[model samples]
Target: MQTNQTYDLLTQVQRIASGDESAFASLFYQFGPRLHSYLTGITKSETAEEELVQNTFIRLAASFPVDRNSKSFRLDLPGGQQ
Candidate 1:
């Protein structure tokens, strides 16, 4: 069950890499709130959190690739790899 979910997620990533805006939006919706919370916790600034979250998604979209090995896929941060 858990593995199936992971597989589905990887498929979504591939779709995103293929220029699927809806897939990317889904990714944003799924991860955005948690990411925002994490950024807010670290910086303790709402504005910074908003900026960082936006930056994160932009970077993610730019870095996306169809053939990427999903098992190793991760979001990188401007502050550094995270």
Candidate 2:
């Protein structure tokens, strides 16, 4: 049985795959603190961790295929199909 956190994460993944920014934001908000803690524990550099977090999110956003048919969404991402 999946817990609420797991279930929510799964739902957010599905939404994000369909280019849901809200879902992605939810996922970021949910994971950022945990990721920060883990990164800090390993690297012990807050600046590096912060930069990595932003870069990681930017790369991740670029990687996902945008759903332009999603109610005239903003963000003119290239390399995606309808």
Candidate 3:
């Protein structure tokens, strides 16, 4: 990932760790449509794509990053589209 993109993600992750729901919403709004489109292209099935996106985000939330080092989950999903 680019430095700028990584910084933005870390910013959001930090906010999320601090109990910022708006930051998480910002993440979803910024990435959700693009994820749906990408998943749809790969899966070629609306139902499957939707399910995959939902599952992916669910898994992402379950692995929240706690700090910049060590505890981070190294989220590179879709090459840092968010």
Candidate 4:
């Protein structure tokens, strides 16, 4: 079950790399709230959480390649990528 979940996540990421807006939006919708909550907990500021979440996604998008060769990849965001 866990492995299947991981595979699904990778597929979503691949869709993102392929310039799928819906896929990116899905990722945002799926992860954004959790990320915001976690960030707010750590920073104790709503504004900071918002900024961190944006920065994290920006960094992830910037760092990832369109033609990634690896089947599995990990991105190390500052507060993590949700």
- State each candidate's clash count: 0, 0, 0, 0
Cα lDDT for residue 18, model 1? 65
Q: Rank the candidates by TM-score, best first.
A: 1, 4, 2, 3
Instruction: Give the Cα error of residue 64 in candidate 4, in Å.
Output: 1.9
Query: Per-residue alpha-carbon lDDT of model 1 for 59-81, expressed as tens digits?
Result: 77778664544443344433333
Error of 1 at 36 (Å): 0.7
lDDT of 3 by residue, 1-82 (tens): 8999999999997887765667767787788899999887699898888778767776766677464443344333343332
**Model 4 TM-score, all chains together:** 0.74
lDDT of 1 at 2: 100
Which candidate tops TM-score?
1
CA lDDT of each prediction against the hidden true structure? 0.74, 0.67, 0.70, 0.72
| TM-scores for all predictions | 0.74, 0.68, 0.67, 0.74
Predictions: Cα RMSD each? 7.7, 6.5, 7.9, 7.2
Q: Model 2: per-residue lDDT, tens digit, 1-82?
A: 4699788777877788787767777666767778778899888898888767666666776777767776533432222211
Off by over 4 Å in 2: 1-5, 71-82
Q: Is candidate 1 or candidate 3 better by lDDT?
A: 1
Instruction: Score candidate 2 by TM-score against the native.
Output: 0.68
Candidate 3: stretches off by over 4 Å: 65-82
Residue-wise lDDT of candidate 4 within 1-82, one digit each (tens)? Answer: 4999889989998887866656666787788789998887699988888888878777767666766453443333434443
Evaluate model 3: give its TM-score: 0.67
